[model samples]
Target: MRKIIAQLFISLDGVVEAPDQWHFPYFNDEMGVAVDSVLGRADTLILGRRTYDSFAGAWPEREAAGGEDAPFAKILGDARKIVVSRQQLEFTWRNSELIKGDLVEAVTALKKEPGDSAIAMSGSVSVVRQLLAAGLLDQLQLLVHPIAVRKGMRLFDEGDAPIPLKLLSSETFETGVLHLFYAPAEQAGEGTYEDAKAHLPQDER
Candidate 1:
């Protein structure tokens, strides 16, 4: 089975929205390599409607321009793109498909289909949260920047419940961004995940 990995660029305060406003300064060679690695891992792309729209609007043009970014643009343009939406969409980008059904079931089936691991990118918080809640997300790669956005859509916001994550690895870039890789922690003793929270650090608790 292919792993469903949700890769997010978030600020110190957990804000994941509009990285365009605060993320450019930190982009460096290391970050480029990290992004390339993520793209290399997936032959399929799972995107929420907003993210899909944002990507479809730009990547195609970049792919045509042929520059340092052309490789990523090609991946975005050529990968099997699945946009999760309830309404019909006229896909302008190549190799794009619309998924309009029970999100959980549909995603679950997609993950089980034979293919390389899939990666989900920005502006897909709601969909990512659903995958996390349903235990469908196999991994989460968070590129955490040092600066805080102060006020924006955060990855973990109000009303969000704690999710257990076991750290798999981490790397620190010279630009002050941290690449944190994690997998879901196995359930402890059959109780709810909240029950396992007792073992977490006081600051986290």
Candidate 2:
């Protein structure tokens, strides 16, 4: 069985939207190491409709332009992408597939299939939340930034039920960003993130 890893860039206050506004200044080699570690483990990319649309529109052009950052764009361009959507997607990026029926069934099947590790990244908050609720998420990675955007889409939005997690590992970068890795705990749906964070060491946390 393959692990479905959901990764996100989240703010101190749980905000995950428009990360470009506050995410770049903090980017450093340490963060790159964390990102590379995740991408290195996955050959497939899972995306929500919004993230699929946004990445499909941009990454291709960026790859074609070619630059110092082109390798990352190329990785996305070459990887197999699966987008989960209710409505049919008219156009899709290269090497991409669409799942338009029964999100849970489709994703669960994907998880059981033989393949390299799979990863889900930004703009997939709703999908990730549903996966957590269904216990379909195998791992969750959060690059916790230091600032609070105060008024943007939050990662842990209201109405989201608590999902328990066991900390696999955590490392704090010099940039003050915290790289947190978690696996769905056996305790499962019993506790909130605050409860989970409390389990981390005061220094590493």
Candidate 3:
């Protein structure tokens, strides 16, 4: 089964939007190198409707223009992708598949499929929330920018559902971006409800 991996850029405050306002400068070569590295590792891409639209509109043209810093050109052009959108338009990217259904369900289905290459979810902060709430994300690659944007979208969104995680790895780049990788923390052996009650003591008054 393929693991659902998420790659996102976030501010110190967890903002994940444009990331250019306060301090997160994408134009810096140092920053670009950090981003390009993350983009290079993906073999499969998943995106939400809004993120898909943003990427499809700009990256394709950028690739055609032959810019050396086309961060996602190679992968986005060739990797298999699943876009969750209700836009009702056929995908134009190579090996792109449209998924028009419930977000969590569609993602869950994808994870169950047979594949070896790592599956990456890029951008799509909203989708990240849904997947986190559903406990569907197997791993996360968070590029925590040193500069905090103060405004715009956030990487991690709060949901009513309570889910826990374990920090699997951490890395720091030259540009001050901290990459954090996490895995879903498996529940410890607490046993059944009866076991819990037994631990509470036998009707101790």
Best by TM-score: 1
lDDT on C-alpha atoms for all candidate structures:
0.85, 0.82, 0.74
Q: List where candidate 1 sits over 4 angstroms from the true fold.
A: 119-122, 187-205
Model 1, residue 62: what's the lDDT? 93
- Candidate 2 residue-wise lDDT, 1-205, digit = tens: 7878888899999999888799999899999877777764567888888888888889888888997777888888787788888887776568888875798998888888887666655558889888888898888999999998898888776674566789999999999999999888766445788888988878954
User: Candidates' TM-scores?
Assistant: 0.87, 0.86, 0.77
TM-score ranking, best first: 1, 2, 3
Window of ten residues with lowest summed lDDT in model 3: 19-28
- Answer with 1 or 3, whichever has the higher lDDT: 1
Best by lDDT: 1
lDDT of 1: 0.85
Q: By TM-score, how accurate is candidate 1?
A: 0.87
Query: Which residue pairs in candidate 1 collide?
Result: none
- Candidate 3 yields a Cα-based lDDT of 0.74
